[model samples]
Target: MDLSELLDDLIRFWPVDVDDVSLIGHSMGGLVLRSAGHHGYEAAHEWTGKAKTYVSLGTPHSGAPLENLAHQASAILAARPETNAFGRLLRRRSGGIRDLRAGSLVDSDWQGRDPDGLAAAMAAEVPLLPGVDHYWVSATLTRDPKHPLSRVIGDGLVLHHSAGGRNSTRHIGFTEDNGLHLGRANHFNLLNDARIAAKLVDWVG
Candidate 1:
């Protein structure tokens, strides 16, 4: 089963084992956790369990547009044979598992979705859980200082929409201001970046 489904099961039978559970997911993990909430929010609250905090690091809560542009099969075939699970998984979905592969690519219009679309469901639903604290952490480089939004110097993977959540506790703006941005680490580097690791230690503890 997927992580999202596991989250659903846990939320349903939470009181059986634990008191309250706080889920921590990075990048797409955050989306899976969020999807868990979007689908299971109603059943979750009645249990003695509670979702304490949600922390997302450059999470494409709205789905990664870059994935759509790259075509998972191409990216996977280009990668080595061993760690290309993502590429294989993409092929499976693109083949027929998904309803409409072409129409599902991310775009500005995705922001307008109501109950059905990803972005809308996440923004509207995930925060509804009682006692849930959300955190949106994003990475960036030096502000170009020319174009308005370009000044942010994002990691080039997570765009603004993917990082935003209404109930977030920390809108960490990493750069030269507080600390230095790591030269490495893209959107997928949830385990990289000493600075980010430090932040997580502080947040979860």
Candidate 2:
């Protein structure tokens, strides 16, 4: 909501008549941007329509398995009275963390559900803007995406397929040419990689 409001303010007060803009998001930031694009304030359509390109860097578009595991762990810990405090802290994650379970992009995706329980099924899909170009970048700590380690510990958090928006169940409609896989790169490094910066410039140019 804050981000949506900020974007609305920026568009309303910007000096120039910004017809187009490029959005580059990293990690959870990407999901927030997607949510804003899907359902923001009244003026959201006006500003979001100006997005010529949307780039996601190491975003868990299909949800993070690691967070699921943490959710389970927290549940177990909460069951024991001795460590209940720590478990409570973990269970009380921000909405952003809870939304990561299924990479939620709208309020309807999670509203009225128990945040600590299993991820709620999305009631409706959030489609991208018709004219906007969506791009994704994924990082892998291993040299080969096929490696067992890479599959389990992708970028130490997100799976390669999830970050690249290649899940078989969901179709975000990103083109093959728009997805890039960076070898030996961790999730955080995706934000600072020169290659990623170059690709963003090229794509958004």
* Top candidate when judged by lDDT against the true structure: 2
> Tens digit of lDDT per residue, candidate 1, span 41-140?
5444332145676676766544444554445454555376775776555554442112122212122323454312223222222333455656666544
Residue 27, model 1, lDDT = 59
What global local distance difference test value does model 1 have?
0.47
Per-prediction TM-score, please?
Answer: 0.52, 0.90
lDDT of each: 0.47, 0.79
Highest TM-score against the true fold, candidate = 2
Count clashes in each candidate, considering only residues at least 3 apart in sequence or on different chains.
0, 0
Instruction: After superposing candidate 2 on the true structure, give the runs of residues whose Cα lies further than 4 Å from its correct spot.
Output: 41-44, 119-124
